[model samples]
Target chain A: MTKTELFNQIKTKKSYLCVGLDTDIKKIPKHLLSSEDPVFEFNKAIIDATSDLCVSYKPNIAFYEAMGPKGWQSLAKTLEYIPKDCFSIADAKRGDIGNTSSLYARAFFDKSASGMSFDSITVAPYMGKDSVSPFLEFENKWVILLALTSNEGGKDFQNLELAEGTEVYKKVLEVSKNWGDSERLMYVVGATRAEKLREIRAIVPDSFLLVPGVGAQGGSLFEVSKYGMNATCGLLVNSSRGIIYASSGEDFAEKAREEAQKIQTEMAEYLDQFLK
Target chain B: MTKTELFNQIKTKKSYLCVGLDTDIKKIPKHLLSSEDPVFEFNKAIIDATSDLCVSYKPNIAFYEAMGPKGWQSLAKTLEYIPKDCFSIADAKRGDIGNTSSLYARAFFDKSASGMSFDSITVAPYMGKDSVSPFLEFENKWVILLALTSNEGGKDFQNLELAEGTEVYKKVLEVSKNWGDSERLMYVVGATRAEKLREIRAIVPDSFLLVPGVGAQGGSLFEVSKYGMNATCGLLVNSSRGIIYASSGEDFAEKAREEAQKIQTEMAEYLDQFLK
Candidate 1:
């Protein structure tokens, strides 16, 4: 998916929230345990409940992967359940050698190969050109490279200043831009790093950003939107536990919708402000 | 598995080859499509043929995730078929917020929760402490962090010289050591960067190194072994396509075994030298 298409969705839906499907089987309602694939059942419910409120749905690969085969089934099913207009992301932070990355691109973007095609996939930029170029090779598909993350250790390296007077994360954003244009490339700048969003925006003003660490992680939507947003409202603020596992009881899906609604409501206001 | 356990297995098998099960459905033998799960069937045959010759199996999650739910099942089954003595890695490069990462840890390390318990997972270290800590919470499990990768773009930011008199990747290795002991953590130093491996060893001498790019990516196992090996033979050199997709025909599995044997024979020599 291109940044322009993502922007159009943001404007049309009036929401920037990317509901994170970090589904955990243990955290799902007890009733789902008996289903053939409880994780998928939970994901389907969450998608059905919150689809209208969010512009995108990001199913983190780790949550699905933990379940072994069942988790993968859940992820595929979850993608199928997600509204096609709502951007889908395989939150699989994959980056490797060029040839290997090409296969990974085929796996995620080529429906014939993997049967699960996501709009985008989270990629780690540490591997450089050969690792990232393969993901960008797919036409119109997006590559969300890791920038300044929301975690505490993000300070360990990302925030470190180089002799060139730029931070490591900033350099990652700058150099990775050469691989693909803003249309096919996005960045994962953690929502918790809201303060850095301003600096990040200056680096890649036209690119869309898959921002995690909102909601349950204490990253403020208002702060991120105000500082990071571009003319097109280029952000997909993700909320995983806050939306998917909002309630562990039978009303979990309802609770998830309610949580997602609250975020979307706020996102609508952000879009309105940006449009103005 | 602990570093000692991994080291002992490498010594006993006389191989440092960590055959990467980056199994793609498109790349698997056509005959396997007749099976209930082609990816799993291929992985089973590959493991059956190569188990004695190699000491580790690393399954890149993207190949399994691409197939959706069915692919994951194949991965779980593949993990099950791999010999218990051989270390199994999820190769799921996952890192997120603390609570979310906790769930990820539960998903990968807690077999009761996911059915596929991998000994280690590759992690993108950009998120900082909270993102990485949750993975470390699981006892005896490991977090193989992206340090200096083998890809061409690795020099983009990882090799950038910081004001602190160290390169960005060198600093990542230095700071992340405090997060966990060598037993619980390893660094991914690409085999293509063999010359720099000596410098990396100086900083992280005891930590296990998950070295990719050794086979088809043109990284020499001989060069990597010379500079990257430690007292415990701390190297899990990976070769993905070169071994796993050695042939795309009926003899695919047999071909995989032959290709793996070639690397294993070379690795056996490396191990012999380590013992000397």
Candidate 2:
């Protein structure tokens, strides 16, 4: 999905919230467990409840993967359930050698292989060009390169000033941006790093940012939206547990919708400020 | 598996090679296509032929993920097929928020979930302490953090010198190391950076290094072993395409065995030197 399309969705839905589908079997409502694929059932209900309110749905790969083959089936099925207009992300932080990475690109982007193609994917830039370039090979698909993350350890390296007097993550964003245009390359800047977001925005103002750590991670939505947003509403604030696992009982999906609505309502207001 | 067990396997097999299962459906032997799960069949054949020559197996998760539901089935089945003594790795480079990361840990390490558990997993430390800590929560399951990668873009940030007069990757190694002991943590130092291995080793002298880029990416085994080897033979040098796709014909398994054998011979020599 192109940045323009993502922006359009944000404008149309009046929301920039990306509801994370980090669904775990243990966390889902017990009543759904009896179903053939409880994970997918939970996902379908969550998507049905929250799709209209959110601009995107981000599914972390590990949750589905833990269930083994069944988890993958649920993921593919969940991908199908997601509204086409709503951006879908396979939050599988993949990075490897170039040849291997190219194949990974095919697995996620090419429907011929998995019949489940994500609009974007979270990529680890640690392996450098070969690891990241493979994901960028697909047209219209995005490579969300890891820059300044929301984790506390993010300060361990990303914040470190380099010999060139720039931070390591800054260089990552600078060099990685050259591999693909703003249309294809998005970055993952943790929502908690709101102040740092301004500095990051200074470097790649035009690019979209996949901002996680927003809701449950304690990153304020207003803080991130105020500092990081661009003209195109260039921010996807992801809330996984804060939304999906809001309730573990029969009303889980309903609770998820309510939580998502709360965030989306807040997002709509912020988006309006930019629209104005 | 502990480092001692892995080291003993290398000593017994006379090889330090970890054959990577970066299996691509398009690249597998044609004969295996007739099977219910071609990827699993291909992996099984390769493991069977080369099991005696190699000490561990690293399955790149993207290969299986690309195949979707069936791919995951193949991955789980393949994990089951690997010899019990051989160290297994789910090369699913996952890192996210603490809560989400905990689920990922459950997926890869919790045998109760999939009946398949890996000895280690590659993780992106960009997310910091919370992201990496979840993986460390599983006892005896090593977290292989990306350090100096072998890819072309690796120079973009990994090599940049940080504020503390340390390279970005060096800081990652230093700070991330604090989250876990050497026994629970390892760093990925690409074979292409053989010359710099000494410097990396200086910072992480006790931790095991998961070295890639050896065969196809032009990293020299001799140089990497010379400079990177530690008291525990702290290395798990991987060769994916070089071994798995050694031949795409019917004799693919035989050819894979030959390819792995060659690397094993060289690794045996390195082990001899290091053990001495």
Candidate 3:
């Protein structure tokens, strides 16, 4: 989806929430275990309950991959079930050398080839430009590059100061901007580091930022919108475990809807306060 | 497999050549397309031909992922088909946060959970210690972290000088050492940058290095061994297209064996000259 269309969806819904489908087989309600595809069934319920309250759905690929080939089948089914108006992200942290990365692009962006096509795929930047540029070859498909991750390991290398006085994450932002414009690119700036979002904005002012760590990771929604929001409300604040596993009983979907609604309500107020 | 076991295999085979199974559906011999599982059929032939010459096999995961679920099934079959003596490397450069990385560890290392258990899997160090540590949790499995890649873009961030005058890749080698010892850890020091191997060897003298960018990518095996070799002849130099696609006709398997034997012949000499 185009940035404008994504912005329009946020405007229409008065929110910029991207509910993460980090569904685990063992974590789903026990009652759903009888279903042929429990992961898909649980995701179907979550999507049905909370689709209107969110602008996108980011499925954590590792969860599905843990189930093996059968998990991939469930992931494909989940992708097909998502509403077309809502953006889909295959949160698969994939990257490699040039030719191999092209196949990865085909894997996530070419539905006919891999039986699933996402609007975007999360890419690791350790391999640099060629590793990330292949994903940009598909028109309108987004490449969300890892910038300052929310994890504790985020501090290990990303925070290291260069001889020129720039941190590695800053260097990633400065160099990668030349590879793709704001329309085709987005940076994943962790919500855990809301202060860094301001620094990130100075580098890529117009580009959207996918912010994880808002809920379960102890990142504040208000702080993220305060530092990260731009003219188009350019922030996809993701909440995975916070919303998906709100309950484990048969009313899990209803409980999930309530959690999403609460976040969306807070996001609407932030949009009014922060939107340029 | 353990480090001693791997070293023993190299000594017994008189080579450390790793034949990369980067099998693409479109790139494989078209005659095999009539089979029940063409990719598996092609990999089976390649494994049968080159198993004796090479001490290791590294399958580039992107090739299989592009074909989707069926491709994964073929990968499972290929993993099972590889002889126990040969070390298997899942060249899937995957890493995420701690919890997510654990799932990835299971996806490749826990065969019962994901139907594939490789001896080693390549991991990207962009997210730092936590992203890499989970893979080390698996017993006897390995994490080959990307240090200096062979691609043109490898110069992007890896070569940047740190504030303390150390290069980024060197810092990765230094800091990540604490996460896993030599027996469980390996570094991907690309063969194309053979000159840099001398410098890398300084930081990681004891760890085995998985060197790619040989053959098709124009890396010199002689230079790699001269600069990168350690006690136990610590190297698994990979050659993908040069061996596997030596012939596209019905004689593909026989031709592949010839290419592998030529590399093994050179590797044997390197072992005799460089083994400490």
DockQ of candidates 1 onward, in order? 0.58, 0.67, 0.89
Instruction: Report the C-alpha lDDT of model 1 over B118-163, residue by residue, as the tens digit.
Output: 8888887767777889999888899988888877777777788998
Candidate 3 interface RMS: 0.6
What TM-score would you give candidate 1 relative to the actual structure?
0.89
Q: Per-prediction TM-score, chain A only? A: 0.96, 0.97, 0.99
Model 2 Cα shift for residue B19 (angstroms): 1.3
Docking class of 3: high
Q: Please report the candidate that would top TM-score against the real structure.
A: 3
Number of backbone collisions per candidate, in order? 10, 7, 0
Cα lDDT tens digits, model 1, A5-104, are: 6777888878888988877776788999998888888888888898878889888876766666556666777787888888889887777767678877
> What C-alpha root-mean-square deviation, in Å, does candidate 2 show against the real structure?
2.2
Question: What is the DockQ score of candidate 2, to 2 decimals?
Answer: 0.67
Q: For residues B237-271, could you state the per-residue lDDT of candidate 3 as single tens digits?
A: 99999999999999999999999999999999998
In candidate 2, residue A165 scores what lDDT? 79
Candidate 3 wrong stretches, greater than 4 Å: A192-194, B191-194
- Candidate 3: residue A65 lDDT (0-100): 88
Candidate 2 TM-score, true structure as reference: 0.94
Q: Give the per-residue lDDT of model 2 (tens digit) for B128-241.
A: 788889888788899998887777767766777666676777878888888898889988887445558878887889888888888987888988888888878888889988
| TM-scores, all models, native as reference | 0.89, 0.94, 0.99
Best by DockQ: 3
lDDT of 3 by residue, A1-276 (tens): 999999999999998999999999889999999989999999999999999999999999999888889989999999999999898998998999999999999999998899999999999998999999999999899999999999999999999999999899999999999999999899888844556777889999999999999899988888889888899998999999989999999999999999999999999999999998
lDDT of 3: 0.93
Question: In lDDT terms, which candidate is top?
Answer: 3
